[model samples]
Target chain A: MSKAVIPGMIARKTGHIINIGSTAGKEVYPKGNVYCASKYAVDALTKGMRIDLLPHGIKVTQIAPGMAETEFRSVRFGGDGPVRHRFTKVWTRCGRRTSPNWCTM
Target chain B: MRGRRAQAVEVRGLIDGLMVVRLAERGRQVKPEDQQQQRKGTHDPQMCWLACELTASGEQEVAWSTGPHAKVAFLCPMPKLILITGATSGFGEATARRFAAEGHRVIITGRRKERLEALRSELEGMHGKVEARRSFILFTSTCATMPLCKRSFPPTGMERDRCAGEQCGPRRRAGPDPGRPSRGLGAHAGHQLKACCT
Candidate 1:
């Protein structure tokens, strides 16, 4: 994003840059180590860019959504049906707690 | 049954009120005194801006739905050109696919060449292929390929010192014109909402 899109936005003297983030950027939970790190990086980068690009009149926004029902679950579990079902069934009850059972992909 | 009946009456009243106001205003001719202001085009752009600000709150609720102001939103148009990174899988792939489905130009980038190629094919079925080989290896144990961009584009040594935005003026403007009067939600419309430009 920095190397390509941002440069273009700066040159244009006007542009909107939306960085789609996740709640993982704010709160860290089990099984979200790498994801959280990346999201945090995005959040920080977004903040820095927003400040730096103000003079250039470039707009930067970060939209962070929570727990979307998408292929993310399928990809994360590698198509493990029972585990996926267990997580689906117990996610509400057990998601906040970082137990080994809930932690594994 | 009683609740449904009440709702019908309320809706009827609302619609009637709206039309009555419209009809009453249409019937009244402007005062001779007010015609001077009209001839002079004395409406303040600032007031136009103030009115926009007052209506901004309610506009959010109707942004995604079929509202009259959904397109252009009485301000500048929303952004159309987008660059989606990490497009090999997951959200990136879905977002890029959506832009293509809507007949908008999209540029999807990722480290995975095969995945990028697959996405390009999916987005462009048998037409419009523009390929440029610029390898930027983001995270690696070694910095062996760090200077690859020096040759075809800007020299690597000087480019690193300056910000990418400072260096790429014409390229950026030539890329997209999303800040114009766009559809859906207006991007770059208000000063406070400058961040929503994307």
Candidate 2:
């Protein structure tokens, strides 16, 4: 994709590439090892692309969304619908959405 | 101390190996069911295949679950040629839905064909081609069956030209150039949008 677009973007001397990053890129957790590492790589590449593509006058921005409702949880967990539903219920019930449901911590 | 305890797995070798196998089997048999199940985040094979394509294409997704405020700001100048990744579900889908409803010229992409198709039909049915509607919904995996220059809905085809309002000449998609993964699209097409959006 970069091979194809960089030429055009460089030639045009006008374009923007916004790469989606994650908080995982900057922080680390137990089960988030791979995701964190991958996001870190994204951050690295965003920096690299910013530097390299700067001459061509292309804007490179990385958006590291903290978190929200998305299929990410589904993808991370797998396609098990019931498990996902129950898990989300538990998650939302806990303060990610509502509070006083389960303050175990 | 807390930061030092992270144990990141080194699965680059395994992932790279699998990607190679997928690349080798590019033009082989694919199950339509796999195509359909892609939207729901189901089917391991489908997800892996789409992930491989994205990884191969080297396009970073730009989705966020924050809100329409930030994105709406980005898509300013009003109607945008938005190129969303993972539009099959979640924020991607919601963004696509909002944009389509507002009648923007979008170029929505995702790993799921069925979901993409479904979105197209719903949008068309509700608000059919209201001027700024050359919206292209690209199912991430390269589809050979889909033509190069036409307004495809479910089995959507991508033309380099949008706004299907203008003469097809101005917007005609370029050739299946070198280093492009599939058709006139499936490769640098994402960057093409980046340039076009600029």
Compared with the true structure, all predictions reach lDDT values of 0.42, 0.47
Q: How much is the lDDT of residue B114 in candidate 2?
A: 88
> Which ten-residue region of model 2 chain B has the weakest summed lDDT?
B12-21
Model 2 error, position A87 (Å)? 8.8
Best by lDDT: 2
Which stretches in model 2 have alpha-carbon errors above 4 Å?
A: A75-105, B1-78, B129-133, B142-198
TM-score of model number 2 = 0.50
User: Residue-wise lDDT of candidate 2 within B16-54, one digit each (tens)?
Assistant: 011111122233333334333322223354344454344
Give the alpha carbon lDDT tens digit for every residue of B68-89 in model 1: 2222122112324445666666
Least accurate 10 contiguous residues by lDDT in model 2 chain A? A96-105
Error of 1 at B109 (Å): 1.5
